[model samples]
Target chain A: MTSSTSSSPPSSSSSHSPSPSFPPKSHTPATTAAGFIKAIESGSKHLLIKRFTLRYPEQKLKFVGDGYQFDPKRAVGIAGLRGRHILYHDKCTGCQLCAITCEGIAEAIGMVRVDEQWKHNKKAIMPQIDYGKCVFCGLCVDACPFYALFMTNDYELASFTKEHLIYTPAQLAIKPKYSGDVEIKIDDHGASHHG
Target chain B: MADLEDRISESQKMGMQIVKESDDDRLMTLSVGPQHPGSGHFRFIVKLDGDYIVHCDPDPGYVHRGEEKMTEYRNFIQNIPHLERPVIHDSTNITYSYSLAVEELTGIEVPRRGQFIRAIASELNRQVYTLYWLAIYGIFLGHSTMFMWPTGDRELFIDLLEALTGARVTHAFNIPGGVRNDVPDGFKDRCLRQITYYEKRLKEYEDIFYNNPLVRQRTEGVGILTKEDAIRLGVTGSVLRASGVPYDIRKAEPYDVYNEIDFKVQYMKTADSFARAYVPFLDMRESCHILRQLLDKMPEAGEVRAKLQANPRGPPGEAYRRVESGRGALGYYIISDGTPKPYRVKISVGSFRNMLALPHLLVGAKMGDMPVIYWALNYWPVEADR
Candidate 1:
C-alpha cells in the first residue's frame, strides 16, 4: 500500500495529506534571494570562529588510560590504540599463543629463542614483532592467555631502516616513553586542541 | 583503440553518410575515474553529447582484493580486520552484520550491554562516515568551506571512537560474538557532550550548504530518480529513502538495539540530487537521537563479549545478516562447514547496489551535474568493489 502511493507522481498522490508536495513548492526569486543571503550570513559567521586544526608533531593529542590490555581470566580486552606491543617477560610462558594468532592475521609475530632463561618461560623463547607487517588489530594481545601482552600509547615508531621495524623480545619488553597532553577543548569561541 | 578504428573504417567503407568528421562525432566518450579528482578509486565511461551525458557505464573494481576469497584463507575471527577494511570509516556496522551472522551460527548469546554498546559504536561510526562523504561531496561541488567544517567537526566522533574502540577508522572492534572491549570511563558523558555540540554544528551545515541557492540550483531537479525507478533499480539507503520509499534497514530490520531506539526514517519525496544529499543530513540528525536513546537505555554492567573457545567453529550451516551502515544496508552471508574458516562468504554492499542507479540516472543528466549526481548517491568506491 505504501509502495503504491510512493510510486505514483506527487501530483497524483494528493489523497495522502501528509505526503510533502513534490516539486517542493517551486523556488521563487524572493525565496532564492533569501537563501543566498542566509548562505552568505552563515559563511561570514564562521570568519570569527576559532580554527579547529590540531598542529601535529608540535601539539600531540593526549590519550586516555595507559593503553589496551587484556584479562585472560575474564576473557575481555581493554580498549586503546593498538600501538606497539608490550611483552611481560615474567608472564609470557613461551606458549606462542600471540605468534600463532598473528600467523593467520598479519604474520607479524615470530616466536624467537631468547638466551635469557626465565623460570616461567620453559622454552626460553618470546615473540618478536615486525611492526611493518602489523596492522595493529590487537588480536595478538587478546591471544595471550597469561595477561602477558598489551598495547601502549607510543605510536610514533618511525625508523630509518627496515631492520629497525622488527622489534625483538628484548625491545618489545621495554615500555615506550610517550607524553602527549593536548586534547579537544570546546568553549564558546569554538573547539580547539588544548595542550 | 584498434577496434574503434576498425569499426569506423568499416562504417566508412559501407558508404554510410557521415555529416561531420570523426573528431566531431556528436558523442564524446570520457573516463571519469581511477585518476579523476571527483571519482575516487573507481572509473566510469560517460558519453557526452554537447553539454549532456548521453550514456554512462560505471566501471568499479579498481580496489578489489577478492575480499570474499581472502576470507576462505582466514578463520572467522581473523576476517574481522580485513572485512572492515572495505568501509573502514564505517567499520563497526560492516563488522556488526558479520558478528550477528556468526553469533547466529555459533550460538553465542551477546549480553544486553554489549548490544547497546555495539549499537552506539555503529551510530558513532555512521556519523563519522557520513561526515567524510559530505566533506568529499562538498569539495566535489567547489564548496571548500563545506569540506573543512565537517572534516574538522568529525574529530569529535573520532576522539569518541578512539576512546571507545582503540583505532580511529579501522576499528576492528566488533568481533563475531560481540564487541572486543567495553566503553572506557566517562565515555557516555563525553559522547553526549560531543553529540550535543555536533548537533549545533549540523544547523550551520544546513545554513551554508543545503540552503545555499547555488547548491540547490545545481542539484534540485537534476538526475531525478522517481520512486518506481529507484525501487526498480534496487538502490538502497538514503538514495532509496530520498525517492520516498522511507525504507531504513535499521527501522525495517531492527538489528541489535535498533528496535529499542525510537527514531523516524528520514526521507524525501522529490528523489532528485538535492533530495539524495539532504536525506543523509536528516539521517545524521536522526542518528543523534538514536545515539542518545541507546546511551540512556544501555545497561550499566554486563559482559561486552561472549566467551568463545580458542578457535570457535560453528555447525555446518549458513547465516545471513545485515545492518544499516553509512552507505546503506550492508549484508554478509557466511557458509561455515563446521570449521573455523568459512567455506564461502559473500558481502552485499549498498554502494554496489546504488551503482545500478548511476547509469540509470546519469544517462540524461548534464555533464556539469555528473559530480553532483554521483556523489549524492553516497557511493564509496572501495566498498562497492569489495
Candidate 2:
C-alpha cells in the first residue's frame, strides 16, 4: 500500500537520464581502452597537486572560538568543535544536572567531591569525565545551565592506561593550547588542505 | 508469509540432507563478515557449488546495540546521540527522522530557515554517505582509484558539515525543536565554492568508475532485479529506483522543503547492478543542484531553534515520520506518555528492509559477483542490524 503511493514519478529534471535497456559494452576493445585511459588520466592529474592529508600530531586544525559555550538566555549552543569537556569551578553549583543528563547517554561525567570550599558549589562536587566511554556528543556541556561546562578543542585524550583516560575535575579545569590554522581550500587546480 | 516460511524451512531441510549426501561433492562454504574487512559488521553464509552459490543465509546482529530498547531509557533530547549511533556516517538523516517524529509528539514548530538548513544538512549527508558507499564498493570490485577519489572528494562535504555541525562523522546536529545551532557566518560562499568543486570532481568519477568498461563487464546484467520483483520484495532507495520505480521519498512524501526544491528522482529501467550503481551517481548530481537552490532560497536570519521547557513533554500520543536517507527510507515511530522519556521508539530502517532481497538475489549468483550484487543493494550493515 505504501509502495503504491511512492511508485509514481515526481517532476523530472533536465539532467535526469532514464535508462532504456541500453546494453553496456564491456568487452569492446575500443571502449575498454578509452575507459582505462580516462580513469588513469583523471587519477594521475592529482599527483601534481598537493595531498589533502594533514600530518596529524605535527599539525592541528585551528578552531574558530575558545570552545562550545552555552548562553542561558539564548537557550542554544554557540557553534564550535566538540572535543574535550572543560569545567569552570567558579560557576559550578554542584546541581548535578550534568550528571543527570549524562546518565542515559555516555555516563562519561562522574561527580567527585572537591577539596576546596566555594560559595556557589554547596555540594563540593565536580564532574570528572571518562573519555573511554564518552562519544564526545557534548550533551554534558548543554546540560550546564550555570555555564560551568563546555567542550574545548583538545581531542587528543589518548592514554596508556584506562584509569588515566578519565580526566579529573582538576585535569578538566586546565585549558588546552591547540593551534594550527588548516582549512579545505578550493582553487582552479583542485581542492587541497591549506594551513 | 506462511508459504514463504514453509518454503525456507523445506529448503533448509533439503540443504541439510544434501550436505550429508554431498560430503564427497565439491560444495564449499565461505563465511563473509562479522570479522572480515570486506564486509561491514555483518555476516553471511554462502554455499558455493564450484564458482556459483547454491544457497545463501545472511546473519546480521553483530553490531546491534539494542537502540530501540535504549531509547526507552533516555528522554527525547538525550536520545539524539543514542539514535544516531547506528548510521554514524549518515547521522543527519537518521536523526532528522527522529526529530520530526519527536517534534510531532512535542509540537515544536521548526522555523523556515531551520527547515531549509535541516534539508541542506540531509542532502550533504546523503552525498557523504553515498560517496562512502561508492568508495567501499569501488574497492570491493577491485577499482582502487574509484575508492580513493570518492573518499577524497567526500572531505569537501565533510568540511562543509564540520563547519555547519561542529563534528565530522557523528554530527548529532538535528534536535527535536530544530538543528543544534544556525550555520556560521560566510558559510554560504564557502559552501557554494566547495559544492561546485565537488560537482566538477563528480564527472571524473564517471570517467573512472561508472563509465569504466572493466566495472561495466563485472556489474552489467549481473543480479538483474526486475521491476516486479523489486516491488514484490519491498526494496527501497536506489536499489528499488534502479529497478525502474521513480519512488523518491523527497518527491513523494515532500518533507522539509523537498516539496519546493526541484530535483529528479533518479531511476533506471535496466534493473542491473550497473543501473543500481548509476542511479546514486545521478542522485549525487541532482543533490548538487538542490544544495545550490536551498542555499540561494534560505532566509537571511530567523530563530533556528524553538524555545522549549527544560524537560519538554507532550500529551499521550504517537507520531511516525520518514525521510529519504542515503541508504533508503529511514523512519522513526515514537510513542509518548506525557513524560520526558519516550514510551516506545521503533526505528523502521531501509538497510534492514533491503536485507530481505539479499538471499533472493544471492542464491544463484556466481562467487565473483557477490561483492557487486551485495554492495549495490545499498545495504549498510550497522544500520540493518540496529
Candidate 3:
C-alpha cells in the first residue's frame, strides 16, 4: 500500500527529524515565479471553456420517465423527481394510506371528499396536498398500496398565497405541463447544459 | 470625578485594562460568532495577542435541531428525511450508518446488489460533500477560481444522484432493509461518463489550488497537530489521516461491500493545515476509484430493498453502526425497546471528534491562519451540533 509523507517544507529542523510512524521526507517548495506562472496558466486555460450555468426558468433538466411511480405488486418505487403528488382517480380506493403515512412526516396530505364517482373510490375522498407543509419526502408515494399516489416531475410549486399552495384532489389529478429537456453535455471545450 | 475613579479601579481589578493607558494589555478577546461567514453557524471565543491566538473556546450548536430527541417521535422509516439533514451534501453516508444500525436492530439482511448500490451512492455522496467543502476551503483561502471549479464539477455527481435517488441532496434512499430504488436505466453509462470527466478535473484542482505557492505558504506549516496529540485528542477522518493515523472506518471496519472493493486509505504524514486540506483531495480521488470498483462489481439484477411491514418494529436491543463519510467516520447508535420508534438515537459524527483538536491546533497559531486552520479540519458545524 502506497502512503504519502510530508509534501510541504518543514517549519523547523526538529520537526524534520525521523519518526517510525511515518517516513521522513519533505519536498522543497517550488520557486515563487514558477508557482505563480502555473497558477496563471491553470486559470487562463478555463477562458476558452464554455460557461456551465443552466438558465433556469428557461432551461430545465430532463427526467428519465413521466414521474416517480410505485408498483404495489413489485413493492418498489421507480426512480424520478420527488415533486408534486399525482393521484389516479380510477386507481385510488380512498384507503387514506397516503394521508396516514404523511401524518407522521409532513402532515401535508388530507383526504377531501370529491364529487366525481369512481368504482374503486366508493367514499369519494382523495388526498389534497398543501405544498407549504410538504417536505417532499415521497413516503406518501411509498405508502399507497393501489398505484393511486405518485410524485410528478413538476416541482414549480411556488404560490402567491398560502391558500393557493394547497392542491385540491382535482388539481392534484390534473397532470402538470412541464417540458424541460436540457441536459449536461460534456465536450472538449467544457461541460454545459444543452438540449 | 470620584465615581469615575472608583469605576476605573473596579474595572482594573476585574482584569479590564484601559485602552490608552495599558500598553502591556495588548491581548484582545474576539468573538468569531455566528455572524462571521468563515464560522458557518458556529461561534468561538478566541483570545488573540497581536497576530497570534492565545486561547480558543469553540461554541457549537447554532443550528441544533435536537436530531437525537426528534428520532424518538418518528418511526424508523419516517426519520429518514430529517436525519439526513445534518450533512445533506453527504446525506447518503449519514443515512447509510443509520440504516445499518436499524438493519441490525430489525434483523434484516440487505441483498448483494443492494449493498453494491449503497456503496456506490455513499462514494458519490463523499465526492459531493468533499467538493462542497473544497469549494468553501478555496473561497476561505481567497482563491475564487478554486471555488468555481469544484462547485461546477459537483453538479455532475448531483445530477447523477438526482437520477438515482429522485432528490439531489436529501436522497432518503437508504432505508433500514436496503435502498429505496434500483439504479435507473442508463445510470451506469451516465455515471461512468461523468466520473471519467471528473477524474480529469481533479488535476486542475492540484494546479490552481494545492500547488499554488500562496496557498502553500499560508497553510503548509500553520496549525500543526502532531500524531500523538491527534490520537490523544480523539480526532477521526481526514484530520486523523492528515496526522498520519491512516485509520479510515471503511478500511478498518469494511462495512457492506467495502471489504470486497480494493482501495487504500489516503493519508499524509505532515499534520499541518496543508496535509489536512490535501488529504480530502486524496480521499476524493480514492472515492472515485471505489465508485469505479463498486459499479464494476455490482451484480446484474436483484432486489434492491427488502419489503418490510408498514411499521417495522425492532426487537429490544441496541445497535451502533459507523460509516466512512466525506468528513470522517459517521456513526449512529440506536436503542430499540421492541417498538416502531427508537428509544434513544445518538449520532457520533467525525466533525465533532475532529473539532476536539481545534482548540489544540488554533492555540499558538496566527490569527491570520484561522480560516486555513479551521476549514482544513473538515469540521461541519451543523453536523457537530447535531
Candidate 4:
C-alpha cells in the first residue's frame, strides 16, 4: 500500500528513542505457497524425533528417592513426587499434626483409632486420608514432625465409590507397588523422554 | 418491540447506551459463548455487519472462585495453595508477589540464595506459561504445528520444576519466607541445556508461525492500538509493550533478584496482532538469558526457607507489591490486623486489566481477525474472572 513498507521496520528501530531494545525480525514475507510449505517442513522435521508421550498404566514414570518425605532436622524435603499418603504406624504418635495442618486447605486427613497399638502411638489413632478431596500437596507430609506420614508415587487412587477412595489407617500402612525408573534425557540430537 | 427489550437490557448491563437505528438491519449479533472451542472459560458478545464486527462486549466472571474472599478464611501460610489455584500453570509468579508482600509485612528477610532460587523458579514458570500461551495462539490461527511444538517444549520446564518443587504445574513452591526448598542437584545443568535447545526451537517458531506470509497478512496491520490508546486504556503486559510502550513491570519496577540480573524488555512500535504475538517470543528468549545469569550468580549453599512460626503474623498494616508474571503486572494487596489471618487480600491481575482493551480492538475489525486480536492481548479467562 505504501513505498515505506519494505524498509520501515529496521529504520524505525534506530529512530525510535523510547524503545532501545528490538528483537531481530525477518521482514521479508514469503509467498503464500512457501509459508505453507515451510510450516509443513518444520512439522515433518519432528517426525524424525522421538515422541514425548508416556503410555500410562503400561509405562509409569520412575521417581527418585523413596517418594516425598521430610527431614525434620534439615527442614527440607528429599525431593520426590507428591502422591498418595503412606502412614508409618511405628513412628506415629497420634499427634494429629497432619490433620490439623490440612484442616483449612483440603480437610482430607482424619485421625482414626486402630485396633492394634504401638508404644509410640499411645492414642492408637492414625490419619486416614480421603483421596477424594486430597490435592496431593504434601503439606501434611511437611507438618509431620515424627515422619509418620509421607507420599509415595502411587497416583492411581481412582475408585467407583467414595468409600473406596478413602485409604484407611491400615491401608495407609501398606507400601505401594510402584516400580518406576524413567527420566527425560537431553542429548545432541534433541530431548527424549527415556527409560 | 418486545424482541428489542432483551437487547436493551443487555446493553444497559454492559454499561452501554442503546439507540434504535436503521443500522440494525445491516448487523447481526453473535456470542462467542463459554461452550465454544475458541472461548475457553470465557464468553463475549459481538455485533457483526456482515464481514466486519461493529461492536464487541466481553463477559468475564464465568470461572470466578472468589479467590480474594477465600483468603480471609485461611491463614497466611494455608492460603498459598489457594492463591495459586487461579493461574495454576503459572503458579510460581502468582505466589511470588503474595509471598513478597507477606514477607514485607512480617519483616522477614529472605536469604540471598533463597531470593536467587525464587527468581529462577519465576523465570522457568514464565517459559512454561508463555509456551502454553503460544501453543493456544498457534491453534487459534490454524497453525497446528505451532500448537504441538510449544506444548512439547513446555514439558522440559515442567520436568525441571517437578524435580525441584515436587509438583509440575501447581507448584506452591514460593512461600512467604522464600521458596519452599532449594534447587535440587543437577538442576542448573539441565535447566541451561533445555533453555539453549529451546532458544534454537524459537527460530523454527518464527519460520513457521511468525514470519509466514499468511500469518503476517492476517495479523501485521490488524488490531492497531496506538501508544496513546494503549496508555489511555490502561492495558498491561505484552499488549501494552506491543503498542510502542516499553512498560514491563520487571524493568519499570524491579522486584526480588530482578534488579541484579541484566535483561532488556522487548517492545515493538507496530501495535498489531503480529507485534503482540512476537513480543512474548522475544520475552521468552530474554527469560532464558535471565535464567542462565541467575544460575551463574546463585550462592553455593544456604537455607532456602526462613524459620517462621507455624502461623506467621504481621503488625496491623497494609503492604502492596507487584511482579511481572507471564501475562503482565500481577500485584497483591494484603492488609493484616496483627493476626495469623489477613484482614483483607486483593489480587490485581494482568488479564483483567488487558481485557479493558478487548472491545476497543475488536470493534470495526473483520470477523476473521477476532481470534488474532483477542488472544494477542494475552488475556487469560480464569485469571480475569478470579
**Cα deviation of B126 in candidate 4 (Å)?**
0.9
Q: Pick the candidate with the highest DockQ.
A: 2
TM-score versus the correct structure, for each prediction:
0.92, 0.93, 0.91, 0.92
Return model 4's CA RMSD, one decimal. Answer: 5.0
Error of 2 at B301 (Å): 1.0
Whole-model lDDT per candidate: 0.86, 0.84, 0.85, 0.84
i-RMSD of model 3 (Å, 1 decimal) = 9.1
Interface RMSD of each: 5.6, 3.3, 9.1, 8.5
lDDT value, residue B66 of candidate 2? 94
The TM-score of the first chain in every model comes to 0.84, 0.85, 0.82, 0.81
- What's the lDDT for residue B158 in model 3? 92
Each candidate: RMSD:
4.6, 3.5, 6.0, 5.0
- Per-residue lDDT of model 4, residues B195-232, tens digit only: 88888888788878886777887788899998778777
lDDT of 4 by residue, A85-168 (tens): 888888999999899989989999899989986887788998999999988778888788888899888888878999999999
Error of 4 at B375 (Å): 1.0
Writing each residue's lDDT as its tens digit, candidate 2 over B75-190 gives: 88888898898998899999999999989998999989889989989989999999999999999999988888889888778878877887889988898888887787788998
Candidate 2 regions with alpha-carbon error over 4 angstroms:
A6-28, B1-26
Please tell me the TM-score of chain A for candidate 4.
0.81
Q: Model 4: residues >4 Å from true position, as ranges?
A: A1-40, B1-23
Model 3 residue runs over 4 Å out of place are A1-30, B1-25
Task: Encode model 3's per-residue lDDT on B1-386: one tens digit a residue.
Answer: 99998998998797454454544577787889687788998988888999999888888889998999999999999999889889899999999999999999998999889999988998899999999999999999999998888998998889999999899788889998888888899998888888888888888788778878888888888898988787777788898888877677776667988878777767788889999999899889888888888899999898988879999887799999999888887889999999899999999999898888888989999898899999999989999999
Model 1 DockQ reads 0.41
